[model samples]
Target: METLATTEIEEDVDRISHLPDFIIHNILSRIGLWDWIRGGKEHHSQLLRLSVLSKKWFNLTASFPYLIFRIDHFHNVSRLNFFKYVEYATSRFCHHHNHVTAHTFKLSTTLREPAELDIVIKCVELVLNKGVRVLSIDILSVLGVQRYRLPNILSTVSMLESLAINGCYLPSSFMVNALQFKSLIRLKLQYISIDDEVIKYLNTSCPLLQDLEIRRCNGFKIVCVTGHQNLQNVTIAHNTQVERIHIEAPNLSELWLDERRTMQMNLVSCKKLRKVTYFGDLLPNSNSGFLSNFPFVDTLMLDTKCNNLKLSSHSLRTLVLLSNYDLEDIEFRTPNLASMYSRKYLFTMQPSVVSDSTHLKASMHCNPYGYIDATWFQKLRQFLDKKNGLEVLNLHIRTTCSLEKRDLEKLKAIELPPYELEHVQLQLDTQEESSAHRNFVDAVFWCCRPRSLILKSSSPLIDFEEQSDIVKFTHEKLLEQEDQSRTKIQIVPSSSCEAQIHLSDLKSLSKALPSAEQIIKFIKEEA
Candidate 1:
């Protein structure tokens, strides 16, 4: 036994001697710290065990980054453990250089007071002192006297490009006194008061700012900027004074407005805007009237729960509306249905009513209450003319509650023009009709022969990427659980609201979808 153990030791020594010190160091340095942290909780012991392999391995693995020390989990992880993890990670990555450039720490808790905030600040300082590029803190309120948390984080990180804070309170924050922020590109703040002072400070302090997201925030007179063409997103929410926002971001493509407190949408500016989402109670009062002048249209998401919608756009192709489908109010119009975007409206019916898009594709969403007469579906089919045209379509169908058999059957029987439809979807309440709904999807597929088919039940969304990243993360986490009951995809279902979902379906054939002319023949043959 002693001879056997001695032989094994000699073999291990021979393996270690084959590699130079620099090669061992390089191998250790290449270990991605974030991957280990996110992979699973079981990796903790494995990471530690790797350090015990050999002295060279120990030196390398001990110094590499292995986790993101988020302060929000401090309660669960003691200060001793957090520092230990950090020390272990920093030692591995910054052993020779004394600093790294990729270290990251995230926090999602309200710093109750300076004492509590100081602990986290010290943690940040410890990591930033070494090196950090990205940091996210979800602060309910900065309850500390150390006001310039913003400047502290902004100034400290030399390579920081992304920063985020949740529930920002300016009156209670120390960042109000921050004079100027250095190089920054992406900034996200939810419910963070961007009063005139904050806006002015950002306009001057962070000149190179690019991406900005402010959710549920109030007190905005006007958010007018001239520079920052790289600005891709500018989201403002929960305010009544958005009437004077003069956007100058030539590169901006996504804009979100949540007007729960006020009513004012005048779309005369913003030439580069491509995506627009509006929420809150917008009853179209004098203060917040409907938009009449939109330069163009791109993607529009309307939350009808707030009872406001804008369907006017020359470039409008993708339209999403989140409304209750329980009420029987149904008014759908596509005047620009043929030319580049469809400019004329006609009540004429072709030999058949099922229409398809010959020109640009259309995306629509309907969430409401009550039964829509088959006439609306009839009109839609006629406009589509699937026999002679090709179209790309996406739809989300949802109801507040269950639907009666008659109403459900009507929804299932809905159809579009054949051959022209390239994409189709159905977002339905899974409880009321899961098995029977397959036929509805099948019929549309038979007609349109779409390339992709999305069948979502009990909700209104169809596309996976269309949902919020945070929501996506949550759903993924639920799916990871061992318990199957919690992993199901059935959420809230209601019947009080109207449901309008653009039926999306998948193609059955692997061959490329035929051209319009070829599709016409293909449809005739298939029929």
Candidate 2:
């Protein structure tokens, strides 16, 4: 019987080995090699053991198209050993699969010595020579260390399609008269110092470039991208030195600008622009007419302190406003607006949406440092009143003060809205557990009762005891209402699909709930 079992097992292994090359490669790709790199040596050994199955399996593993070398993964090894491991891995892979091209190669490492950078550059060159299509390199070095300069050899890689370089430097000298990237489609540069000349070079040379992202990079004051017919998406964010950006891409669809200070932005002939996310002050004289340039804009996110900004977009679908305390008024004339999200300090002027769309979902985030009285709730109610045809409301509150018993009574006395929302989400961030939590919960129910209530806390310092106290208090309050009204409240863990629990079973299962970020759903069913 043992001999027969051994033969059967061998036969089964042989059958798996005989699978087609593409099937075997597909299976290997789904093994999640990137996830296994974060595990211990035992898990890595298990993955390595797959190579011993057969000569074909060993060769297949050696020729794997995705190569990732993250130095942080080898935390147990010394710096010298880390360098040696990377060198050995790159050389071995290249030697074994010299004829086969890799699909992607990612390298992330901290550079302490100049020699380490040379090794990285050599490895990148080897991969590029092998026609790797997608490459991502992230280098972190000492504060005063010289930044990694882009090698001239990079311009020769015609097969490279997507490239991302972080914490590196791009010199204008390297880009001057450099050859074009015929196949390059996407480029992302972060934490680098690049100038306008390099940007101009890329715009003119790389005809196939579609997506470009420049974040937290200095040295260039003006980004003038003109006549890029193939450019589709552009993002230039958080650059302190950038003063003006002028783009005339006719095919551009999305543009995101998140500058710290005010900058002049000019968009011409971008009739296909669908979304614009601006996080800085608009021009002093700019008003509603500024949006006329983007006639087809579907989504707009403005995070500026510009006061009295009037946004009138007929085709706008989604709108997000994040304002400083200084912002006073914003009037929206978007009749087709579908979603609106606002985050700001309390008492700021809420945006007035004139949309008639019934699918409008509104989210409000308020962080009031002072006490919460009846006035705040009244203001919230008035804000919700302007959103016509509103379906769902999500409210996030972060406050230091809790509603006292006296204030709670005043809040409850206010008349509730006649129409209930389809869903209401309440994310509370408070300091501690207090008697006022119950009052706050009651105040929320008075404002706008919804058929479904989702509750969670966004406080990072909150412990399990505090989270449980809030959950228990909420459950008790909902149960008390269930006894008098026809509404039946069913509690379920939002992260789980298990059977819903009755009100009486909550205390027993309270300890089973996840802490801090746990979300509990309360479905109100009319009996």
Candidate 3:
């Protein structure tokens, strides 16, 4: 009995041995805030029970300021509990006032009634008082509901550096006259209705702002973004402004715009603008704006119906265009745009885009629906093939091509040179999760693993995973058929940077399959 007691006491003492403060802190920091709060009420609580294990854990978990309290569409949380939970969870930041580096409040679309919305406003008010640096709000639930003007609660957070607001309607006061945040460095505003108020605020405030995006805003009435000394990159989308924009940003290196029909811009300056996305056609009436502006850009994206683009003095080397313009008639200096690609939807009528240079690449999306004019498509392909241009051609394997492998063969056989085609595409259809479907996707992408390519998928996550597994499995089968030592194959996840590199052809993949097979096998072994 004495021996047993002595052993038990020693074990207990050993279990309570000191853990380094840093290690303890690391464990507490990893605990989710909501998990900690909810665990306090449950029988088999994970977080609350952990707090009692050590005094150090309790303090650190309680003090961690960077909290992510997401109240989105799916969760086991009640409305009242969620509201109370937020108030309690943010109390540390609201009352005690710590420097909250990042505070995210993601609301759900289930807030059907006005009372629920009011509760949200109050909650937002509390968090703003925390002086957060990053505030991101996505309120797509406010789609059809009548928009109530947001109170000046956001103006109080003066230390804010990055603000991302989407799908929320803003009142004129916050946009035009508000001088609340002076330290804002990066601002991304999308799908938010705009008026004169917001335009004035953007021009006056955010003097030190470096990155700005104004996209798909319905109520956008004005464009006042002019001479900013510190602005570097700007992406403006779907603006219905009256007309006429004069830009003179010396440090502004990149500019993108998908403006409305009435849009007009006189780039009296943007001399250092290396990257440019010209969207709509420069209107005939706006000849004054066009004649006065001169662009000395390195990279250009023609993403509109603007076929009459005239490049006078551009050192442009890379270009990405929308489907509609012809490249045959275009003039080129020392520029080589054959390194770029185009993004378009399927079954859409696309004109053959023109480029004087042949170093183009197809890093953009092919139409997912379908393409109407195969002749135009053939012309572009032949042009690329003739120049030995474009390292990759990213296509929509399913939706973009209405034909099967036989039909594609007919198209490929049409009197073209032996330019090794490096075709890249994605099977984003959910049905591709099956073995046969996965083979189809694999067949499309495996046609070539060019030196560089970026293929994106639109399939849902589960379908994407299933399709990925099938593609990988098919690659394994192909490796077995080919000589293992001669082929070099690299199976990279779609998320990796290496996923961007596509090669010459399916035959080449068979040749390179050995190396890629070895890589895949090694990765699985390490796992």
Candidate 4:
């Protein structure tokens, strides 16, 4: 037995070692640039380990065109040591990949002193001199007084394609034409302090720029994105002091804004703008004609507290409205609307014409301990009655804890109008205990008789053993009470929640609900 085990181990090693060098290189290359350096630290030690495997792997790993050097002085490192480490690593990386072009060079560090700022400038020049195309520099300071002023040689890099700067100030004294980046396509600036002159120079020079994102940035009040023919997408969010925004890009397709405060917006000739998301206050006194500028908008998401909203667009398909205030009236006139998502207290929807929409998603936050208002039944009934054309309905209701047994029974007693939806989804945010979900399922069954019922739990605890008891009890009780012969109930873990946390997908759910499967197996045996 010992001999056989040793032979198997040797054969496995031989299988991997005998593979072609190209296959091994492909496997190592698939590790990706972002994955190679994780946790804001270079994996030079790990790469050295990979070098011991073979001479071919060593050469391939060293020749990687993506050079990432990250330093965080917040972790109790001296400024001199940080500068020396960066300088040595950069020198070695540039020497090793001399023949290859720099695909991406990302340098993220925190610099406080004027001397540290000089080191960053020298490093930037070194990388740019190596034909760097994609560059991202994040220079953060603990004290907010100092800003890393970019070098003048930045504009001279004509081969640059993408530039992202965070917490680094731009050179404000440059000439209007001196800040030209002829081949740049994507620009992202975050937490940077730049005035109107810098914004104007960027708009005038980078005519080929397509995507722009400004987040939590300060210094300029008005942002004018005008006459950029190739500009397609723009996003501005979480800037409290931006009092005005102007856009005249005719070819722009998507615009996203987290409008925390009401700003004077002049959205002019964006004829191709198809998607818009505005999440903040839309006061009555704000720009009235701002939304009407986009004639071809398809998707709109508005989270506003305005009591009355009147919107007219020719080509809208998906609309999401999230308002804390109870909606008195909403006048949405879109002929091509199809999907509607809302988290508002619905009073009435007065769309100028009824849309041919088939999907309706309603989300609400519920405190399990709080008492449910009796008037909610009427409102929910009216909303359901109005959605007769809905073919699919998804309910995302979150609760703090499990419901009491008496309350669950009382909830189950509420009479709900039967819906004939083809597919119904119930997404609940619950803990390990599933009593609330069981009760919620009973209430859902009373309301909608869907062909397929999908129950998804959004919490982290998704153990089959813990969930089996609830599934078995609910299944047995449901079988006894109702003749659900045509309905198929599927208990699935929340796909969206699991995806966000990078959880592995479970394909089959049969083992989790064994009682239900056993009943079907018994019936098959009898036949």
Quote each prediction's TM-score.
0.54, 0.66, 0.56, 0.62
lDDT of 3: 0.53
Local accuracy of candidate 1 as per-residue lDDT tens digits, 280-335? 55444431233333455456665645332224445654555455422223233434
Model 2 gets an lDDT of 0.71
Q: What does the lDDT read for residue 57 in candidate 4? A: 62
TM-score attained by model 3: 0.56
Report how far residue 71 has shifted in candidate 2, in Å.
1.5
Return the number of clashes found in candidate 3.
47
* Candidate 3 lDDT trough over 10 residues, lowest sum: 518-527
> What is the C-alpha lDDT profile of model 2 across 1-527, one tens digit per residue?
99999888777776767887667877777866554433335546756667555557666766777778787786566788777766766777777877778788888888988888888778877777777888898888886656676676777787888989998765344456765578899999899877778888777767888999999888889999888889999999988699888888889999998996777767857889999998777667777666775778888877776557678878887877777432235555666676665565442222332122344354443445456666777666665665555556566666777777787787667666633666766777777464565667777776775667788766432455555666677766555545546667778776563767766676545655665566778876775
Worst 10 residues of 1 by lDDT: 518-527
| C-alpha RMSD values across all candidates | 15.7, 9.8, 13.3, 11.8
Over 1-527, each residue of candidate 3 has an lDDT whose tens digit, in order, gives 99999777756654523665456545555654455444233424665465456445555555555555556632566767766666676665466535333334444334556766676677666677555677776555545555444457676567888887776766445754666667888888777777766767776777788888887776655566776888888888775553655566778888887784656566657777787877766676543234235466766666555434444333655656564555443333323443445454322112223222254343334444443233444544544433334444545544433334554455545654323433343434333335434434434423333322223344433433443465456555445434667664544443342442232233332333332121111111111
Better of 2 and 3 by lDDT: 2
Pairs with backbone N, CA or C atoms under 3 Å apart (clashes), candidate 4: none
Local error of candidate 3 at residue 311 (angstroms): 4.0
Candidates ranked, most accurate by lDDT first: 2, 4, 3, 1
The CA lDDT of each predicted structure is 0.47, 0.71, 0.53, 0.62
Error of 4 at 361 (Å): 14
Task: Kindly report which residue stretches of model 4 are placed more than 4 angstroms away from their true locations once superposed.
Answer: 1-29, 32-47, 53-64, 72-82, 93-101, 113-115, 173-175, 283-290, 327-331, 344-371, 381-527
